[model samples]
Target: MRVLFTSTRGAGHFYPLVPLIDACAARGDDVLVVAPSALEPVLAARKQPYRIGGEPPREAMDAIRARAMSLAPDDGVSVMVAEGFGRLCTAAMLPVVEEVCRDWRPDLVLHETFEFSSVVAAERHGIPHARVAVSAGGFTAQADPLVGPVLDAYGSGIAERLLASPYLTRLPVSMDPSPYDVTHRYHEEPRSAVLPDWWNGAKEPLVHLTLGSEAGALPTAAGLYRGLVEAVGALPVRVLLTTGRHLGPRDLGPQPPHVHVESWVPQEDVLRGASLVVCHGGSGTVYGALAAGVPLVCVPLFADQPANARLVTAAGAGAAVVPANAGGEEPTVLDPDDVRSLGTAVERVLAAPSFRERARALADEMRATPSAAELVGALYG
Candidate 1:
C-alpha cells in the first residue's frame, strides 16, 4: 500500500504521525511525507521519504499569525477553527499536494487533525484519508459553535470531513468527559524522561518549565522565563527550564543557583521525575505532564494553549492563568505583575497535593488506552 502523510510545518503537528509512519514502513508499505522544506531535516533524520511543498507565501503566513494573535482571549480556539486554519493551510499546500497525489497516487492520505488541506486534496482525488490526533482527544469541532461557518468558509459540506474520519482512534480516557460509556481506546507511546547528570542526583523537589517551541520564540516569552526564574529562585526546589531552540541562557537573564536552564531538553525525560510543571498550555505539553502524573501551572500564551489550559484545569490535573499582555494585538512583554501572577499560580500547585493526586488518576486512565502498536494491529488486522 502507498501511504502519504501530511502535517502543518511544526514538530507538534509532525511528530504525532511518526508511529503510523513507522508502522507502514515496518509493514512494507511505501510511505511519503508531504510538508514544507523547513521539516525536511526532521523527516530526513527519521529516514522517511518526503516531498517538500516549498513555503507558504509570506502574506498567508502573516495573515495566519495576525488572526491568531487578534483573537479574543475567550474566543481564540473557536476563532481559529472559524477562520479555518486547516482550510488556509490546505489551500497553501494544495498545489504541491495535488501534484504529488497525482503522481504518487497514494492508497491512503494520513494527516494530522489540524492539517485539513490534505483532507481536501485526498477527497478531491477519491483517496481514503484518516485524521490523526495531535492532542489528547481528537479535535472536537462539534463542541464549537462556529463549526458551521468554519466549514462553509472552507467550501462544500466540509464539516463532514471532521466527522468522517474514524478519529485516527479515540480520545484519551481523561479527556472523554461524556457520561455515555464509550469503549475502544488508543494507547499512546510512553514518555521516558532522560535525567541528565545535573538532575540525576538532585534530592530537591524538581519543577520543570517549558513554553513549547512556538511560544518561547515570542519577544514577550523572555518575561515569562524570567518570572519563572524568580518564582523558584528562592524556593528550595530544583528548577529545570527549556527555552526552546530559539532562546538561550542570555534571553532568560540571570538564574538563581537552584535553577538549570537549557535551550531545549527531552520534556518527557523531565516530566518523568517532575514534582510540578510550569508551562505554556500547549496540548502536547499538557498531555505529556498528565501522562507522567505531574501537576501543572499553565500560563497560556495564545492559540490553543489557553483552551488546552482550561481543559487541564477542568480535568482537575492543573491550574491555569493568562499572562497580562498575552492576547493583546501589540507585541506583549510580560511585566513584573504578570510574573508575580505566574509565580503565585506555581506556588498554589506546589502547595496542593490534590493536584498531584488528580494528575495520577488521569495518568492511570491514559495508560488504559491501547498502545500504538496495538492500534496499528487493529487498523491493519
Candidate 2:
C-alpha cells in the first residue's frame, strides 16, 4: 500500500504521526510525507521521504494574531484554528496537496487533526484517509464547528468527509473518557536518547520542566521561564529545565548546580528519571508523563493546553496552575502570586503519593492498548 501523510508546520502537529509513519514504513508500505519547508530538517533527520508544501501567508497570520488578541483564551484559540489552520493553511496547501495526490496516487492519505488539506485532497481522489489525533481532549469536536464552514467553502461536504474518516489515537481512555464511534486506540513506544554527563548520578529526585516547542517561542515565554526557574529552583529536588529549540539555556540566566538547563532533551529519556514533570500541558507531554507513570504540575499557556491540563488534573495524575488570560493573543506574564501557586502545586504533587499511584494506573491502562504496529497491520495488512 502507498501511504501519504500530511501535517502543518509545528513539531507538536508533526511528532504525533511519527509512530504510525514508522510502523507503516517498517511494514514495507510505500510511505511519503508532505509537510512545510520548515520541517525539512526534521524530515531529513528522520530519513523519511517527503515533499514541501505551501505554508500559511505571513500577512494573513499577522492579521489573525492581531484579531485573536482581543478575544478570550478559548475564543482566541477558536479563531486561530478556524481562520488560521482551517481557512488560510488549507487554502494555501490544497492545490499542492491535490497535485501530489494526482501524481503519487496514494492508496491511503493519513493526516494529523489540524491538516485539513489532506482530507479534502483524499476525498477528491476517492482515496481512504484517516485522522491521527494530536491533542488529548475533544479537540476535533471543538474545531469542527469552527472549521466546517471554512472547509465547505473549498468543497461541499469536505468537513463531513474529515469527520467521517477513521480516527487513530494514542490517548488512553482514562485520560480522555469521551466516546468516539470511529476511534481506534494505539500505543506509541517511547523514544530513547543518550543523556548528558551532567544528568548522570543524580542522588536527589528529578523534576523535568518544559513548555513545549511552540509555547517556548511565544512572547510570554521569557516571563514563564524565569518564573519556573525561580519557583522550581527553590525546591530541594534536582531540576532539568529544557528551553525548547527557540531559546538558549543562557537566556534563563544563572542557575544553581541543582538546576540543569538545556536547549532540548528527549522527553521520553527525561521521564525515565523524572519523579515529577512540570510542563505547559501539551498533549504529548501530558501523555508521555502519564505513560511513564510520572506525575505532573501543569502550567498551561495557550491553545489546547488548558484543556489538556484540566484533563490531567481530572485524572488525579497532575495539578494545574493556569496563568491569567492564557490562550489569549497577549503572552501570559506570570505575577508573583502565580509563581507562588506554581511552586505550591509542585510541592503538593511531589509530597502526595496519590498522584504517582494514579499515574501508574494510567500507565498500566496505556500499556494494554494495541501497539501502533498492530494497528498498522489491521489498517493495511
Candidate 3:
C-alpha cells in the first residue's frame, strides 16, 4: 500500500514518526515522509522519500511563549488550546500536505496529530486517513476496552467519528513511545542497546532529571537550574540532567558528586537504565522513559506540559508540581522561587514502588508491541 506519514514541525514532534516510517518501508510499503525544512536530509538518510517546509523552530517556540505570557489569571488549558488552534492552522503546512497527497495519491494518509499539516492534507484529499498521535491526544487508536468511558465522559462526537472510520488506523494511546503497531526498519535490524547514561553513574532505583530543551532557555532558566541542582545535589541516587544547550557547566553553578549535568546525552540511552525520571514532561522525555521502563515525576513548567503531566498521572506514572505561572513562577534562571522544592518530588518518585511497578508493567507491554510494519498486517492482512 502507498502511505504518506506527515509529522509535526518540531524535532521532538517528528522523531516519533521515524520508527513507524522505517517499519512501513521494511514491510514493502511505499512510504513518503513530509517534515520541516531542516529534517529533509534526516529523512533522506533514513531512505524515506522526503520534503520539508514551514515555520522555523524558534518562531514556533516564540509564538507559544508569547501566547503563554498573555494568558490572564484564569486562562489555562482552554486558553492555550484555543490559541494553539489558531497557531496551527496555516498555509505553511498546507502546501506540503497538499503537495504530498496530490503527488503520492496514497491509499491512506497517516499523520502525527499536532502535524496540523497532515490533518489538513487528509481533509483536502477526501482520502481515508488514520491519525498517529505522538502523545495521548490520540484517543483514536485505543482498544474497545477504554473507548466507552472516554466517549461517555467527553461526548462521543469526535471519538465516535474516529471509531467509525473504517480507514482510520490509530497508534496506541500512550504518553511515550507510541504503541503504534506498524511496519518499521528498527525491527529488521539489530538495535544497538546502549542504555541511558544514568546507569553508568550508580545502580537501580536510578533517578533521571531534565528540564527540557525550552525550559532551560526561559528567562528564569538559571534559577530553575539551581533549584534542580539543589534538589538532587547530594541525593543518594545518580542524577543525569540536561540543560537543553542553554547553559554550560560553568553557568550551572556547583554540581554534586551524584549529579552529572550536560547539554545533551542520548536520552533514550540513560532512560533505558533509569528507575525514576524527573522531567518537564515534554512528550519526548516522557515517552523515552516509558519506552525504557522508567517511571516519571512530571515537573511541568509551561505549555502542553501540564496536559502531558495529566496523562502521566492518569496512567499511574507520575504527578506535577510547581505549576507554570503559579504565584511562585520563576521569572529568570536567577529568580529564586525555591528550586529545591523540586527535590521533594524526586524523593517521592524514588520512594514510591507503585510508580516503578506501573512503569515496568507498561514497559513490558510496550516491548511486546508489534512494530509499525506488523501493525500494517493487522489492518490489511
Candidate 4:
C-alpha cells in the first residue's frame, strides 16, 4: 500500500501523525508526507520522504491575525481556524496536494485534523482518506461549526463528506468521552531522545515547564515565560524548563541551581522523571503528561489550548490557570497575581495524591488502546 500523510506547519500539528506514518513505513508500505517547506527540517530529521507544499503568505497571515485579535479568545480561535487553516492554508496547498495525489496515486491519504487540502484532493481522486486527531474531541466539536462553512465554500456538500470520514485518535475515551462512530483509538508510543547530562543527577519530585514550540515565539512569550519562571523558581523541587527553539535559556535571565533551563529536550524523557508538568496545554504535552501518569498545571495561551486545559481539569488529572483576555494578538500580560495563582495551582497538584491517581487511570486507559502498528495492519494488511 502507498500511504500519503499531510499536515499543517508546527510540531504540535505534525507530531500526532508520526506514529501512524512510522507504523506504515515499518510495515514496508511506500509512504510520502506532504507539508510546507517550514516543516522540512522536522521531516528531514525523521528521515521521512516528503514533498513541499504551498505556505500561506505572511501578509495574508498578518491580516488574519489582526482581524482575529480584535475579538474574544474563543471567537478569535474560530476565525483562525475558519479563515487561516480552513480557507487560506487549504487554498494555498490544494494545488500541490492535488498534483501529488494525481502523480503518486496513493491508496490512502491521512491528514492531521486541521489540514483540509488533502481531504479535498483525496476525495477528488477517489482515494480513501482519514483524519488523525491532533487535539481533544471537544476542540474538534468547536472547530466543525467554524470550519464547516469554509469547507462548504470550496464546494457544496464537501463539508459533510470530509467531516464524516474515518477519525483516528490516541486520546483515551475518558478524557474526551465524545461519541463518534467513525473514531478509532490507537496507541502512540512515547518518543525517546538523548537527555541532558544533568538529567541523571536531577532530584526527585521533578517538575517540567514548557510552553510548546510555537507559544514560546509569540509576542507575549517574554511575560509568559517570566511568569512561569517566577511562579516555580522558589520551589525546592528540581525544575526543567524548555524554552523551545525561538528563545534561549539566558532569555529567562538568572535561575536558581535547581531550575535547569535548556532550548529543548525530549519531552517523553522529561515526563518519565517528572512528578508534575506545567505547560501551555497543547494536546501533545497534555497527552504526554497523562500517558506518563504525571499531573499538570496548565497555563493556556491560545488556539485549542484553553479547551485542552478544560479537559485536563475535568478529568481530575490537572488544574488550569488561563490567561485573562486570551487568544488576542496582544493579549494581556501575566501579572504578579496570575503568577501567584499558577504557583498555588502547581503546589496544589503536587500535594494531592488524587491527581496522580487520576492520571494513572487515564494512562492505563491509553495503554489499553490498540498500537499504531496494529491499527495500520488492520487497515491495510
Candidate 5:
C-alpha cells in the first residue's frame, strides 16, 4: 500500500505522525511525508521519507515570535495561527500535496486535522482521508461555542471534500483524554515514537517537564525552566526538561544537579519510565504522559489545554494549578508556586496508586482502537 502522510507545519504536529508512517513502511508499504522546507531537516534527521511543500510564512513565524507568554490567550490570539497564514499555507501546499498524492497514487491520505486543504485535495481526488488530530485541545472545533462560529463556517464542506474517518490514531499520551480518544478511540494500541538520546534509565524516579513543541520552543521558555529548577530544587526525583529547539542552556539559566535541561528529549522515552510530568497542558505533552499512564501536573497555557486539563483532573490522573500568584480573577504569569504545588499533586498520584491505576485504565481504553496504518487500509481499501 502507498500512503501520503502530511502534518501541520510544527514539530509537535509532525512528530505524532511518525509512528504510523514508520509502522506502514516497516510492513513493506511505501509512505511519503509532505511537509515544509524548514521542516525538511527534521524529517531527514528522523530518517523519515518526505517531500517539502510550502514554506511556512515568515510573517506567521514572526507572529508566533511576537506573541507573549501567558496562562491564557486573548480573543485575537487564537490557537489556529490565524486565517491569513492558514490560507497561504494551504494555497502553497495544494499543488505539491496534490502532485505527490497523484505520483504516489496513495491508497490513503493521512493528514493532521488542522489542514482543511489536505481534505480538499483528497476530496478532489475522491480518496479517503483520515484526520490525525495532533492535540486534544484542538478538538474544540467540534464543540466550543466561542470557536464554533468560525470553525463551523470554514469547516462546513469538509465532509463532502474528503471521506472522514476517526482512523489515524493519535498517540494516547498526555494529561487528559488520551490521543486515541481525540480521534474517537478507534485504535488497539497506544502509538509510540522515536526517543531522543538523553533518556537513560536511572534508579531515581524520573520527572519529565516541557512547555510544548512550539510554545515551549520559545525564547522565554527559559522562565519556566528556571522555575522548574527552583521548584524541584533538592527534590529526590531526577528531572529531564526539554526546552524546545529555539532555546538553549544559557536561556534556561544554571541547572541544578537534579535537573537536566536540553534543547529536546525523546518525550515518550522518558515518559515511559517517569514518575510524573510537569508541563503546560499542550495536548502532545499531556497525552504523551497519559499513554504511559503517568499522572500530570498541568498548567494550561491556552486553547484546548484547559479542556484537556479539566479532563485530566476529572479523571484523577493529576491536578491543575493556575499559577497561585495570578490575580484579578485571571492570571497573566503562570505562577511558580502553583507548579511547586504540583509536586504535592504528583506525590498524591504516585503514593496513592489510584491515579496511576485510573490513568492506565484510560490507556487501555485508548489502546483498544485500531492503528492509524490499519485504519488507512480500511478506509482507503
Candidate 6:
C-alpha cells in the first residue's frame, strides 16, 4: 500500500507524522511525504523522501497575519483557524495535493490535523484518509468558528466532510482534555530516542527550554526568549535552551553560567535526561516531556497552546501562566516582565516531587498504548 502524508511546513505540524512514516517503511509499505519548499531541509535531514507542495501566495499570507493581529487574545485560536493558517494553507495546498493524489494513486491519505487540503484531495480521489492530532487533545472545539469559513471558501459543507475522517491521537484519555469523539487510534510517544554530545555528566537538575520552530518565528518571540533567559538565570538548574532556526545568538543578549543557548539541538536526546522543561506549550514538547517523565513550566503563546497548557496543569504534570493582552479578553504572548513570575513557577516545580511523579505515571500510560507499527498494520489490514 502507498501511504501519502501531507503537512504544513511548521515543525509542530510535520514532526508528529515522522514515527508513523518510519513505521510504515519498516513494514515494507511505500511512504511519501508532501510539504512546502521551506521544509526541504527538515525533511532532508530526516532522510525522508518527499515532494514539494508550494506555499500560499504572499498576499494571502499577509492577509492572514493582519487578521490575526486584529483579533482579541481569547479569540486567537478561533481567528487563527478562521482567517490565518487553516483557510490559507488549505487553499495553498489544494492544487498540489490534488495533483499528487491523482498521479500517486495512494491507498491512504494521512495528514496532520490542520492540513484540510489533504482531506479534500482524498475525497476527490476516493482514497481513505485519517487525521493525526498534533496536540494532546484534538483542537476541534476551538475550531468551531473555522468550519463555516473554510467550507465556504472551498464549497458548502466542505469542513464537515473533511472532519468526518478518522483521527489518530498520541495522548491517552488521562492527559486529553477535549478528546475527539470519532473513530480514534491511540499510539505511544512517536519520537525516536537519541543521545547528543552535549549530555555532560552534570549533577545539577537539567532543564530544557524551547518554544518550538513555529512559535519562535512570531514577532513577539524575541521578548519571550529574553524572559525565559531571565527566568533561568534565577534558577540553579543547568539549562539547554534551543532557539529554533529562525533566531541566532545575536537575538538573545546575555546568559548566565547555568544557561546554554544554541540555535537548535537534538530534542529527543535532550528530553531523555531532562528533569524539567520550560516551553511555549507546543504539543510536540508537551508530549515529549511527558514521554520522558519530566515536569514542565508552560508559558503559553498564541493558538491552541493555552488549551494544551491548561491540560498539562489539569493533569498535575505542570504549571501555567497565561499572559493577557491589552484587550483583556484572554491570554496571549509571554510578557517579558513576567520573568520573575516564571522563575517562581519553575522553582515550585523543582521543589515539588508530585509533578515528577505525575509525569512518570503519564509516561507509563503512554508506554502502554499501541505502537505506531501496530497502528499502521491495523490501518492497512
Which numbered prediction scores highest in lDDT against the true structure?
Answer: 4
lDDT of 5 by residue, 76-193 (tens): 2353434422445666677888787666777778787565456667766767777776655335343323333333344565543332355344444443243233244444344356
lDDT per prediction? Answer: 0.73, 0.86, 0.60, 0.87, 0.64, 0.77
Considering summed lDDT, which 10 consecutive residues are worst modelled in model 1? 176-185
Clashes of each: 4, 0, 24, 0, 19, 0
Q: Model 1 clash pairs? A: 90-117, 187-370, 193-269, 194-269
Candidate 5 regions off by >4 Å?
64-85, 137-140, 143-156, 159-167, 171-204, 324-332, 372-381
* CA lDDT for candidate 6: 0.77
Taking all chains together, the TM-score of candidate 2 against the true structure is 0.96
State the lDDT of candidate 3 residue by residue for 1-381, as single tens digits. 888887655566676676667767778888877776656655766877777757535666466646655554224333333334223433456676688788778887776644444545565566776655544543223332333333333233433444344332221234333334432211112143564453454663557678876566677677676776676666777777778766776787777667777787767667656778888777778767766667787766655566677777878876566554542333423223434556677778778888778777766666665665676677655
Q: Which ten contiguous residues of candidate 6 have the minimum total lDDT?
A: 324-333
12-42 in candidate 2: lDDT tens per residue? 8998899999999998989999998878889
Distance from true location, Cα of 186 in model 6, Å: 3.5
Model 3: lDDT of residue 61: 49
Q: Could you tell me the C-alpha RMSD of candidate 1 in Å?
A: 3.0
Clashing pairs in 6: none
Q: What are the runs in model 6 whose C-alpha is more than 4 Å off? A: 152-158, 177-179, 188-201, 324-337
Candidate that beats the other on lDDT, 2 or 3, i.e. the better one:
2
* lDDT tens digits by residue: candidate 6, 142-201: 675566677556666666766666778777677774445565545554455664445365
Better candidate number, 1 or 5, judged by TM-score: 1
Looking at candidate 5, what is the lDDT of residue 273? 75
lDDT of 1 by residue, 1-381 (tens): 898999888887787777778877877888899988778878888877888875667687667677767766556555555554544555677788888788889998888767766766777788887777665442344333455455446567665665556566334555654222223456567657568757457688999988888777676678767777776677778998998877888876776667889987877788888899988887778877887889998887776676778888988888887767778786665577776777777778888899999999888887887776677667754
How well does candidate 6 score on lDDT at residue 121? 81
